[model samples]
Target: MLSAYLLVSHGSRDPRPEIALQQLTELINQKQQSYSSSKKLVGLAYLETRPEPLHIQIKEFAHHAVLAGCDSLKIIPLFLLPGVHVMQEIPEEVALAQQAVGKDFNLELLPYIGSNPGLTKLLSQQMAEIITQAWVLIAHGSRRPGFQQPVETIAANIGAVAAYWSVAPSLEAQVEQLVAAGKEKIAILPYFLFAGGITDAIAQLTETLKLKFPAVTFQLAQPLGASAELADLIWDLMKE
Candidate 1:
């Protein structure tokens, strides 16, 4: 059966994240074309801060896929956390899109990209060159009780600590804690797929923290951008 893959990201006012998502969509399509005779159509959608509402975009993509003879559509959330957007907003939009598209199409919502185990390894690779330093995985955390678990799990896997942007144990607080714990050298890794406003904020916060803890050395690593490994991760998620 012909299939369409919709890579949905949380929309951003900053163009960088949206551009990165489009680049990633192209990468995924290229990867799909390389292996499959029946090439799957790939598209991008955003949840908010975009010109089009998510349901409308989903409907448009679904219609386009249907016209291209795709009987199935799989949506993969590019979010790193199982926040309100992932758990509630996206599914609600998908339901609306399904209603708009009718029952003839097979639509499925896949797991968030962060659920991929390979991602932790990918993240670990980013800091491989550095010597032993306390690592902190920063994410756009949700106040929702269980949302922090994935970030915590990833941090634990890498022997690091977890910090949030929107919740308690802010990035600064975490850095302070690490300093108090006598960790002089620290690495702050943004657990994000692409560079956006939040990532920018993280960078700014790191700079401020560096000034605050004059003795402690803080190095901020780049976000997981559009890479072949990341494209492979998306393909694997789609296959699953």
Candidate 2:
């Protein structure tokens, strides 16, 4: 049966995230084509910054997918944390989209990107070939209870301490702890999917951290961009 896949991301004002999402959509579709007899239709949607809400976007994509002979459609959330967005908001949006999409089409919400076990391995790979006395795996953070556990789990798996961008115990705090422990070289690994305004801000903050701790060396790593390894994870999710 022919199917369609929708890669939904947290919308960004910066153009780079949309571009990267486009690339990721392409990569996933390419992977689908590689092993299937017919190409699976793929699309991108945003949770914010779009004229249409996620439900409307899903309806539109499902409309096209139905027209394109897709019997099944999967909406995959590209979120790393089990916050309100992943736990409640997005599912509610998907439910609304499902109503608009009607009954015949198989519109389903798959497990989020963060739930994929392959992510731990993928994150370890994005660390850039560097030796450091300590590693800090920082995420965008969420206020939702228990959301931070996954970040801590992934960080622990990769031998890094988890920090947040918008919440308490920020990256600076983690660095402070590391410094207090006499770690001179540290790597700041962004647990983000793409580089954009926040990553840029992180870079700027890294510079400030550098000046603040003259004796310590900090290496900022790139976000997990639209890479094939990530595509592989998404591909696996579609099947799941």
Candidate 3:
């Protein structure tokens, strides 16, 4: 009985997230190879942008996995926050997939990638190399009331203020607050796994922020891309 692991993400139309996910998939596969045999399976799935919904994707992947001798499967959500998708949608999809897959199959939904404390530590390490008096930890925010808690917690852990891309306490607002607090050198870390349209928009916003706050210095860090370090995190998420 083989155990197959599938990394699921909020799908994108830009193609970059998909590319990064595939790279991550490869990295996880490489790590899996190191600790285990060549018999296991590692794959990628999406919650959107495909013709099929997530449950269907999970079902199809599980079907393929079973054919490849996989009896048990773990679905790991690659999300960075415990947003609506993580707290509600993904688990619902997993349950639907579990129901459809039936008795003999073992389909378990693992905790999301963002739920790991190691993630904040990784973010801290990323900022350690950059010189800044203060930091703004930004993410694509959720409309869900308590979703900002994780972002705030991570920011607090890293000695930074929190900002959201699509919600209140935006990057502009955060920068203004820092500038008002006498911070001259500030850095912004994108709390994402890869560079996407939102990251580009954040870069543009930084350019605008620089013009707005000419006296205050600003630096923007890359999102946690598909590096071995991130792969190591994903590898840790999957016990297979």
lDDT of 3 by residue, 1-240 (tens): 577988899998998988888888888778878886655687788888989999999999999999999888898899988888888999999999999999799898898998887888888889998999999999898888788888888888889898999999898988888888899999999999899999999999999999999998889999999988888887777754
Displacement of the residue 230 alpha carbon in candidate 3, Å: 0.9
Q: Which TM-score value belongs to model 1?
A: 0.94
Instruction: Quantify all predictions' global Cα lDDT against the true fold.
Output: 0.87, 0.88, 0.88
Cα error, residue 14 of model 3, in Å, equals 0.6
Candidate 2 similarity to native, TM-score: 0.95
Instruction: Give one digit per residue, the lDDT tens place, for model 2 in 136-157.
Output: 9989998887878888899999
TM-score list, all predictions: 0.94, 0.95, 0.96
Clashing pairs in 2: none
Question: Which candidate would rank higher by lDDT, 1 or 2?
Answer: 2
lDDT-better candidate, 1 vs 3:
3
Determine which window of 10 residues in candidate 1 has minimal summed lDDT.
Answer: 124-133
Task: Please provide, for model 1 over 58-125, each residue's C-alpha lDDT reduced to its tens digit, 9 standing for 90 to 100.
Answer: 99999899899888789999987788888899999999898988899877999999888898889888
Q: Worst 10-residue stretch by lDDT in candidate 3? A: 31-40
lDDT of predicted model 2: 0.88
Decreasing lDDT order of the candidates: 2, 3, 1
